[model samples]
Target: MSHIEIFDSRYARLKAVDWDFTDASQDSLASIHPYPARFIPDIPRELISGLGCDKGAVILDPFCGSGTTLLEAQRAGFESVGIDLNPIACLISSVKTKELPPEFLPVAHDVYEQAKNTFDGYVDIPTIPNLDHWFKPDVQKALSSLLTHIDEQSDVNLKNALKLALSSIIVRVSNQESDTRYAAIDNNYTANDVLESFLTACNKIHEAKKRNSVNLECSKIFNQDILSVLASDFDKPVGLVITSPPYPNAYEYWLYHKFRMWWLGFDPIQVRTFEIGARPHYQKKNGQTEEDFRKQMSSVFDLLSDVLLSGGHVCFVVGRSVIKGKIVDNAELIRNVAENHKMVLVANIEREIAATKKSFNLKYGKIKTENILIFRKD
Candidate 1:
C-alpha cells in the first residue's frame, strides 16, 4: 500500500471551481497545433496560484506537448521553461511563447498575399510515407505552395508561425483518420478545404498576437528528452513543475502527427526510437510492459529532482490505467518514486476527466478520472 496524504480541502476547492475553460478563448498559440491528452490551461493557472510562486520564479513543464503550461505561466507573469523530445512540440512551444512585434500581423498578411500571388509556381514536396494515400494530388500541391511561401520568410517567428498555421490544417484536409485518431483513412477534402483552413489558422495567429505581451520574460523550449535536459538545463531554480505526462500505451504523439511532421520536413522515424510509453512498448512480442514505463518515469523523477528547488511544488496531472486486468494507479506510482527522493505528497486531488476525452479503450478500460498529485520537495 502507498502512504499518501489526501488534501481534502484543496480537492474540494478544485472540484468547486470549473476546470473547463469553454468560455475563455484559448490563446491562438495553443490552438496552432493539435496534440493528444493536453490538459486545459486553467489547470496550470490554478496550480500556480495555489503554489503562490514569485513573479520572477521560473516554472517548468517537462512534458510540454503543445506549450499550454508555458503559455499560461507567461501570461501569469512568470518565466517558464518547456522541454519536449518531439521537434514539432518544440516548434509549437516556440511560436506560442516567442516575442513578436506589433507589425507581425500585417507582415503575415503580406506573406499570405505573396503566397496567393505565387500559388501557381512549382513546389518541391518532401518524400513521405503514403503521401498519395493521405493527400490528394491537388491538395498536396496547394499545401506545398503554402510551405514554399512560408520558407521564403526571413523572420524566425513569422516563419514558424506560418508553419504552425499550416500544421493546424494538414490533418483536416488529409485522407488520414480524424484528428483524435491515427493511421486509418476516413475522409477526404478538396484543395479549397486546405486553403481555407490555412487562412483561418493564419487569422488565429493574428488574434493570438493581440494578447502578446512584450514585457513577459521569454520562455525557453528545448527539443531534448527530459532525462538529458533536466540534469543541468536551467540556471534559475524551478519553483513549480506542472505537467501531464504521456500514459503507458495510450498515446503516441509522433504517430498521431506523422503527416504533419512529413509536411513540415521532419523525420518522424527519428523521434519514434526515443518516445517513451508508446503503444508498441506494451506488446508481449516487444518484450516491454508497464514495468518499463514505471522505470522510465522513475528516471524522470530523479532527473527533475536535480533542477527543482528544495521547497518547489510538483503537480503531476495523471490518470489511472487498467493494465492486465488490474488497475494501475499512476499517481500512486509517482508518489512512491517522489517519496524516495525526499518529497512529501501534499494532495491526491482527484478530478473527473472531461466528457469528450473519456473515450473507450479496449485494453485500458476507460479513463473516467484524473488525479492532480501535488508534492513538496523536502
Candidate 2:
C-alpha cells in the first residue's frame, strides 16, 4: 500500500477510539506517583497496537513522565526506553518498569517494620530551602527516618521501590494541596501518618507490579534531557516514538516535585535548569521563548529522524497553550518543525480533555483539547 493509504488506514483506526477515556480506570502502576498533566495510558496502548510495529521492536518516550509509555510498551511485548530530566520521574519510571522478584513483597514488609523500629533514632535530614513552609517539623523528621531506612536496603530494585513508595506519599503528608496546585494549604498530616502512608503506597505498588510484570531486560530509562540524547543511546533503531512534550508554561514539574526529589536525595536544582516548557523558563527577562521551544523540538525531531528506522512512526500528543490571551497551536508548530527534519505528518486527531483531568492552572486558561499528531520518517 502507498504511504497515503497506510496513513489513512491508521488514522481511521485511531479516530474510532474514545480518546477521552473518561470512565477508564487508571488504578495501575501509572498511578503510583502523582504527576502534572499525565496523558492517559490508553493513548500509548492504542498507539503501540495500532501503529503497525513488530513485536519486540523498540519504543521510545523521550518525555516519559512516570513511565506511562514504557509500561504500555512492555505490556504489548516490546522493548522500551524512557528519558526525562527530572530525577524523580526517572526513579518512578525505572521502579514501575523494572521487574520485582518473588521475594520483593516479603523484603518490603521487613524493611517497613525495621524502619518503624529505627524511626525514633534516625536523624539525617538534609537541608532543604523553605522546608518548613512545605513540611511540618514532625513530618520532616518522619520522612528523614524513612529515607535513612530506605537507603540501607542492599537490593537495588527493592531500595528503589521503597524510595518510590516514600516519594508517592510526600505531597499528601505535606502542606501542598494537590499535585496540580503548588500553593500550601492547612493540611493536618502528622508524623504518625508517614509510615502508614508509606506502607499503603508500598502495598499498592507491589500489587500493581504483580498485575503487570514484564521482562526487566527489555526496558531502559535515562535521567537526562532529551536534547542531550544521542543516537548511540539506543542499542537498536527505534520502531516507534511516543511522547507528550511539556506544554509551554503550563506546568512546573520541578517546583511541584522538589520536596520529593530532596527526600530521595536528588538535586531539584538540576531538573529546574534543564526542564523544558517550565513556567520559570518563560519569564519575561532572561527567559526562553516560543521560538526556543520550537528549536528544542526541532532538535528532538532531528534525533528521532536519526534513531527511528526507515518508515517508523512518531506520535506526539500535545495540547494548545494560551499565551498572551492567544491560543497557540502547538500541533502545527510540531508539524512544521518535524517536516523540516525529514519527517512527514500523516494524521492530526483532536481529543477533548476530560473535565476532571484538566490539571493546569486557570490563569493560563483551560486547555480543552489535545492534538495527537502522527508523523512517519521518510
Candidate 3:
C-alpha cells in the first residue's frame, strides 16, 4: 500500500484542513489586516524544504492574497513573487514584507515623538469626512497628528510601519460588533483610543520583528490581474507555483473590504471590475451556475498551463462552493482542466475544515473542508 488512496485522496487532504481563526483580540495577527496568507506558505514550505531551497530559491503565488505566501516564503528563505488584483491586498503585503532595518524601533520612537510634538504645537488635523463622524474630535485629532508625523518621516521602513499601524486601528476604533460582517462607528464598542492602538500595533510589529531572528530577502509583490499576470512574459525563470484562486460565485473579496480599501486610498469603484466571483457581479448577471463556474475556472487552468515551467509543480488550494442548488465540484473541474492542459495529476488532498458561516444563505454555510490539488508539468 502506498499509504494513501489515489482516488479522492486529493479531495480528502484538503477536506481535512480547517481554518481555526483565533479568538485572540483584533490586534493579534498582522495588525487589523485580513487572514494571514501563511496558510499555503506553511504547506508549500514543508513541501519544498528538502529540495535545496536555502533562502534564495524562487517561488510564486499567482493568486497571492494579502501576500501570505510571499511573506511566509521570505521568512523561510525562499525568494517569492506574488500577484493579486486588489490594491489594498498589494499594499498590505508590500508594507508587511518591507524589511525594517535593525534600527527601525529607534526610528518609530522618533516618529512618535514628532507626532506628539506636532499635537503639542496645536497643529490642525486634516479632516477625513467619515472618520470624524465615527471618532471623537480628540481621537481623530490624535490619529491625524500621528499620520501626519509618519508622512513627514524620511525613514522609509518606519514610514511603512507607521502606515501599518494606522491600518491596525480600523476595527479597534470602529463601533461595529467584533468579528461581524459590518464594522461602523459606535459609542458602545471598545473605545479604541487612536494613539493607544497605534502604539500597540507599533510595539507588536517591533516585537514580531525582533523575535523573527531569521533573516530573509525573498519576497516581491505585484498588483495585477492574475490571468493577465500569468500571461505576461518572464525572463526565462522557472519556479514552483502555489496559489488559491476564487470560486465562481462565492466571495466578493473586494466589496467585503470596500471600506478598508477606501480608507487606504484605493478606489473601490474600480476594483469591482476584476474581482473574481464577486457576489454583486454574479447577482447582476441574474445567477452563476455550475457550468459557468467550470468554464471560468477552466480558463484559469488554461492560462496557468502556458507559463508553468517544465517539471514545475502547481499547488492549487481551493474550496467547494454551492451554485444554484448544485454542489459545485471545484476540485474535479480543476482536475479536468489540468488534465486538458496535459499536466499529470500528482495528488488531491482533502482538508477537513470546520465552520458554519453565518453569511451563507443556509446552504453553503456548512463548509467542512477544502481541496488542495497538486499537479506537475512533467
* Model 1: number of backbone collisions: 0
Candidate 1 least-lDDT 10 residues:
356-365
Q: What Cα-based lDDT does every candidate model obtain?
A: 0.74, 0.80, 0.61
Better of 2 and 3 by lDDT: 2
Q: What does the lDDT read for residue 367 in candidate 1?
A: 74
- Per-candidate TM-scores read 0.87, 0.91, 0.79
Candidate 3 per-residue C-alpha lDDT over 1-378 given as tens digits, one digit per residue, 9 for 90 to 100: 012223434334433333232221122334436442224334555445422232333677777776666666666666777777887677666666666667666766776677766665675655344665555556656666776767777766667666776666654565534423554545543223566667777787777656543466545566877656655544334356777777666766675555555555667777788777665655665765667666766776666677667777777777677665566777788888888888887766665532332112223434556666777776
lDDT of 1 at 133: 78
lDDT of 1 by residue, 1-378 (tens): 112345545434444445443343455555557776556777888888767564456899998888888878887788899988888888888877887655666765675666566667766777878788778887888888778878888888888878888898888888866876656565667666777778888788778766665367445788887767655667777889998887776667788777888889887887777787666656556555667778888888887788778878888988776555567788888888888878878777666654553311223547776777888886
**Candidate whose lDDT is highest:** 2
Q: Which is better, 1 or 2, measured by TM-score?
A: 2
Summing lDDT over every window of 10 consecutive residues in candidate 2, give the lowest-scoring window.
Answer: 1-10
